[model samples]
Target: MTDALNAPGGLSRRRLLTAAGALGAVGLAAALSGCAADDPLAQQARAGDNKNYVAGDGSVTEYAKDTRKPPVDFTGVLYDGTKLGSKDLVGHVTVLNFWFAACAPCRVEAPELEALHTEFKPQGIVFYGVNLRDEQGTAEAFEQSFKLTYPSFNDKDGQVLLAMSGMVPPGAVPTTLVLDKQGRVASRVLGQLERGTLKTLITSAAAE
Candidate 1:
């Protein structure tokens, strides 16, 4: 993956991170090496949970204002063919969840995500799903099953993921990121979301 990312016309890790306003080179090195022994996602991988996906332990990281990187920028086409970009998110709190239809945790969290989207929409907050592995039909089916109102990006080619490579792990499904009004990542949920916890995270980011 690293090699491919650095290949011609591909995004190198450093360049991607820098472009997305993610942690700097030094910080990226630390983050890559700092996976804790007790991290649920790591433990699940080693244990062969057979869940097919490593579920996050609902861990959350909130970045302080001074420590936040620059605003993130990327362009993507939503399922409905609507184009969305970082500029669309400016001055608004945004939530981006990486998911595919079959991920169990994603299925479990869909309703909650939608509820949060509805609850916060009037407050000028936006939510978007970055569908990593599904085609438009499958993604739409999942959304219909959950009755989700917010639109999702069809990230099949990994363009959105590539843009977000620094902050999101390579194949970590069900990861959620909260971006502040300035478009910088303000917080993140590593696994399945706990509604109250995400709500608090969103509320805090909105407050800022």
Candidate 2:
């Protein structure tokens, strides 16, 4: 993003970490190289192996209707101290974003998520964040700075992450999942978000 885009003091202003690199940049990718240390893609990035892994490339992937598996159901506490679960997400499409307060790419995608939330929320799609790290205060600060209205789960104990287990795995620190109305995992973006791709996915999911 340009300096103008990162400028502060507006309703849409972003008080992002200046030192953190932009999404899809080599520096930003390097920072998350081990964000999920055991994740194969992260390992490849760290080793400079350049294998099948396109680490932090901001790719958006949607599962074919037949390919989508059963819904992911889990429960945890939100930053506001409220309880949330898969049952709570049913009947409406939902977007689950995995992030932490200090992750640069997470900051990069915050506004986009907020925009999607603003657009699709009126259509009844719920947006929630799963924070793999950081305290409540930190997460709330990031929420305020990003002007995000969606509630985020506090996964500090890994309850939410553990529930997602093999699927999405929290391997990529900044991953997003779009759940269909039935609560099934319909689409996933494994790294930094692509705004246009996400909008299309959300739009399609909302229509389903």
Q: For residues 1-208, could you state the per-residue lDDT of candidate 1 as single tens digits?
A: 1221243444443254334333222222232222223345434443546276756765566676777888887999998889989988998999999998867667656666887799899999999999999889999988886778999999989998888777888778889999999999888888766666677678878998
lDDT for residue 40 in candidate 1, whole number 0-100: 50
lDDT of each: 0.74, 0.69
| lDDT for each residue of candidate 2 in 1-208, tens digit (9 for 90 to 100) | 1121332342231222221223324333432322243344434444545344233555455565666778787889998889988988889989999988666557656766786688787788889999988898999987887678999999989988887776565547688888898888877777777565576667768887
Could you estimate the TM-score for every candidate? Answer: 0.75, 0.72
TM-score of 1: 0.75
Backbone clashes for every candidate come to: 0, 0
Q: Model 2 misses residue 196 by how many Å?
A: 0.9
RMSD of every candidate to native, in Å, equals 12.2, 12.3
